[model samples]
Target chain A: MSTEVAIVGIGMHEFGRTDGVSGMDQGVVAVRRACADAGVNWEDIQFAFGGSMAAGAADTMVSLLGLTGLQFINVANGCATGGSALFSAYNTIRSGVFDLGIAIGFDKHERGAFRVNTKGGGLGDWYGASGLALTTQFFGMKINRYMHEYGITQSTLAKVSEKAFRNGSMNPMAWRRKPISEEEVINSPMLSYPLTQYMFCSPGEGGVALILARADKAHLYTDKPIYLRAAVVRSRRFGSFEVLAPSIALEHNAGPTVDASKAAFEMAGMGPKDMDLAQLQDTESGAEVMHMAENGFCEHGEQEFMIQAGDTEIGGKFPVNTDGGCLANGEPVGASGLRQVYENVLQLRGQAGARQVPNDPKTAYTHVYGAPGISGVTILSR
Target chain B: MSQVPVTEGVFTWPSDSPQLIGSRCVACGNHMFPVQQGCPKCTAAETEEVLLGRRGTLWTWTVQGFPPKAPPYAGNVDPKTFEAFGVGYVELPGQLKVESRLTEADPEKLRIGMEMELVIVPLSKDSDGNEIVTFAFAPVA
Candidate 1:
């Protein structure tokens, strides 16, 4: 099928904490930069989809950008919020309703362990009082089980974070940029057993914006247009083990990432082998390891070998997470999903400095999976 | 002066061997914890209240050191004095794998596939002086 949505411009407000910088202002910075990068005026956007977790509504930008009276919808689908916004824009533009639009994501949260209100989130007093409400516990349990079943070791998990920090040092937009040894990551304060402070991404503040236009109108904005080949988002049904869930009856079906990537690969008529690189979600080191398998990049039993053999770095076979990923960049929730897309565009356009994969990659894949098992996957090509 | 459940409708109180309060689809035999009116698996409306297995094997576990983020964790305890605890998924035979608080926190004391049994423990006391009881799993000898 012909996917006709093109990303003409991508901009990001570096993924880090900025005191006194409101999420809205961060969004304004990204949006204006994207509009300028696309060579289009803010007034040119006819519609918009925005993702903000703790931030306010999508209409919050209206006060800054002026009341253009555009259709702005706010998305809050966990970590996939930004990816959903991108697809929402793509689907809307492909239907020929709106010619041009923008997708923006931003978030700001207090430092330390990210608190989740389980009152209305399907978790209750029991989960919270027992400390089971924390997402760290989930990641720890999942990885512990994975390691027990497979032969994966602590060294492999530490190596994933090592690669992330190494790559993050190269990307100015990344959050934790200092390159650390695997020993540091392994010895860091253990949040949950096996997952240390370095393994988990802290909640921070950041923003990202992507300008989209019809394929035919894309060149009117920029010559190095990144076409959206496939965009798919999926939700958890039954038997999917994920964060924030209390119990499971049985795992009778696939997880959200598996379902999402499967649908995306089918829609794009391209499989994992066709892509040159990826930005698999790494909320923790285990997430990247698991998602790489979920997204069809490798088998469940191969991550240990691949990561141990130095095959996941920039020059490796797949070169996944070339832009430091959530592990190194720190998750700003709403902004993280599009941050993956922003890096993918840079990689495709040959604009990713220092961390760019060799031999101008033609196609790229990005995937994000979040709490309670919601997933989003996108494919882009030059 | 009395022990009450932290939340109602989750387990039987004042019993020797209490099973998790759950529901099973009468038609498809799917089980759910804390009770769901409708079966999510087969979408069947015919369901009945049932007790989950008390004995199970450990599937996975972890130790949470810091205090959980507040609000729904509603126990009135000082964050600084909060002690570390173990949380895990237990595979109950003929039932689903359910998340549980472990009786032990030390990693050396825990192991995957170890036999475990449900036990009632105090979570926190309520304002009324009642000990808020919750479910946990202890390694079975």
Candidate 2:
């Protein structure tokens, strides 16, 4: 029995380098903007949920925003940090304990590739130094395996990044907007054997905030409120073969995306056919390629053909990553999930100037998955 | 010549054949590498330490053309000495898949389902100059 909740307001900080700026400041800025968008005040927020990989607890807003005496929680769910925070807030608000809540995600991460701490938690020194600890290796190995098993070619792989950049070129807030060609993507200095440097998103800094209100009171905040039809976070089961798993079970089981997406679709009372737009995780182009199938948008071995046919463009049959995605915006970890939600909101609101999906989107889906085998999905409907 | 593992209690060395150390659940017979407190699958508290077989199939691999960030990586090799290497998951027979550095760095030579054998290789040296070694999989000679 899930109660209804509506996202009345959303805001985002520019996705790019934020040198010498603290994540807290970025979060405050976004929060202020969201409150202004909702025609509400900071003091009116009864609860706040925040997500960040490197930043400290978002609960410190008591001193920063002068909005003290409220329940504030910090959530960390690997790359799905923001989605997790938003899900938690939605559930809490739907539970009748709170009427209005703010879910925020912000991060100021170091530039370059992502690396894991190889200490403790059953991992040893060999695991870290093995070079498999770097996420790029996972993407490369995954797509390499996919190609070998599926007969997908390098040219097929290049099409994903090419589309990402082309779509990104239209997004004002995206980090890399210049439309890139297939040759540039395929030849851009391979970071991993099958993955070029441009194929992956660099760890960057940014912030996003969303204000949610109980459904009955939603109209009091804004006339156009995006209903959070489904919010789910799931982890990988056995044989999932997710990043940071160190070992894979010999037996086969469903991956996080599959498990989470099915549950989300069921919870939302919607199917893949009902979704007019989507924002799937694209840690790398290879990830996006696999994710499209894993999320049930297409069948396995069918993505390469879709990429080649350009059916995933804005006006295509399945519009995806319409706001450049992580490839263009880069990843700010905590903020990435909410950033996807932000793009979907704008698309639904018909505010997306150049990247607007055709025929007006009535429903949208956003998902994220990363280290430790976690996936989060959020579905929005008008 | 003396060699030390980067992590103790992970693998057996100084023998004709080296094997990874793993945990086996007594209740469900599930195998897990690097050991675990209890079986995550079966939740069996009764577990036994077992030495894994050194033979496996190269399930998948990738080239690490760029250097990984440091800390646990222990910047032992100089930046000038950096050489790209292959890293991948090697599926043990009827057991589990363990991710390891591959002896071969050439992507053209690496193939899925290739027969792989485990070998101990030196990673870096500690302050006292003890050779720190880690496990890797290579195409069977």
Candidate 3:
């Protein structure tokens, strides 16, 4: 209900691990590409939001982009950092505070294992240490629980991975482009019970940057500007004990993805049924299925059936992760969220090429979540 | 002697030794751990401090079969050494469900709704004999 902020330009560095480019270097490349795509000069940008999880504060990402004159804000919200940054940029522009802004999400996550800063003043000691470790393990444990509760076979989870790899094969940007069979996914190294290596996203390096401007100025930047209809951010709170019933509250809280998605749908004046394309934060294959149900894309425990029915394919009811998701595209932390947004921008712009959803899509949604249950949902339209 | 520099932090036993202080919003009566600069729910900056309980019921858990990819967590253990460590979601007395690591490595033994307590232990030891302590949880009788 605020001022309309449209994505004037989008740019992405080739998605892969690059030894030569640090996070900042890759960020600069994407930023330059976005600026060029938007037909705007670096000096015209009034504000900048840099999103990265692995980089330390003052890590040249903000300054190196030649955005020194702009009001720069650095954000690190775990995996959802990029989407969070985009939300901040949209709000800033919508507030009439800035006319042009850039949200840059770039990360060379291959540098280290994924770690969340659960330091003092964040959560209780018991909740910080054990809770985080427990949540990371929750995916595997939930898969086990799903197996026990629903009588789902290991192959049920494997089918999700097999489909992701198959979709990745058609995506030039995906890290693992080779089609993987169900037997291969089930037989891969088991990280946790019922979850195999192929079931998880491979850690890699990449960059995704987006440019936003006031609706009035959007056409000056690009003829095909994607409008930001809704951007919602929400965090999970410890629900009641009864809410923790048998299968609901396994992780940090009632899946924030669903809550954020619902809020976004209401804010955008639309529902899951109206979505033409979607790019979800699929850190693991099981998450893809869980989120599909939780986000109202499908009913509970019906995601496996949907995948088997090819309802989630490029030509199906709703094409998901056309550029491949974190599972096949690699979860590059900071870059992953914006990377999803970039895919939406491309699909709406009719530039997705081989991975393009069959029908000309008008509305798309991208969702991303981070540690301790930070969630961001964005609704984009042409 | 190892040359790791120990970071200064208190370690608590029975899991909840070092109490986690959180702020309860005076406006909305919402509770948040590790305290917040402002109430995220109602945007209230004024609040009161409360001590969270130690013991809770296990919600669920996972083991770090693979060593974390981050630094300062290196050389202590290899990912292969621990195939499956138990982690759990523990429900505190105040209806708070905290995520924590279980003392048991076998995932099979971990049961839903099992009782658990908090334990703060050393995450790693620096070369200078300093202990980098962090929080974790273990099962209770």
Pairs that collide in candidate 1 are none
lDDT of 3 by residue, B50-116 (tens): 6656777765555656654343233244645633455555666653555445677666677777777
Q: What residue runs in model 3 are displaced by over 4 Å at the alpha carbon?
A: A56-68, A110-112, A120-135, A142-153, A240-255, B1-58, B68-76, B79-83, B90-141
Instruction: Provide the global lDDT of candidate 3 against the true structure.
Output: 0.70
Question: Residue B92 in model 2: shift from native, Å?
Answer: 1.3
Off by over 4 Å in 2: A120-122, B75-77
Considering lDDT, where higher is better, how would the candidates rank from best to worst? 1, 2, 3
User: Candidate 2: DockQ?
Assistant: 0.73
Tens-digit lDDT track of model 3 for A132-222: 4223466776655555555556666777777778878887777788989999998887665557778888668777789999998888889
Model 1 stretches astray by more than 4 angstroms: A1-3, B74-80
Candidate 1 steric clashes: 0
Share of real contacts kept by model 3?
Answer: 0.18
Query: C-alpha displacement of A305 in model 2, angstroms?
Result: 1.1
Indicate the DockQ of the complex predicted as candidate 1.
0.70
User: How do the residues B1-141 of candidate 1 rate in per-residue lDDT, one tens digit apiece?
Assistant: 999887778889889888899899999898888687888888888889999989999999999776776654654347678777889999988879889889899999999999999999888877898888889999998
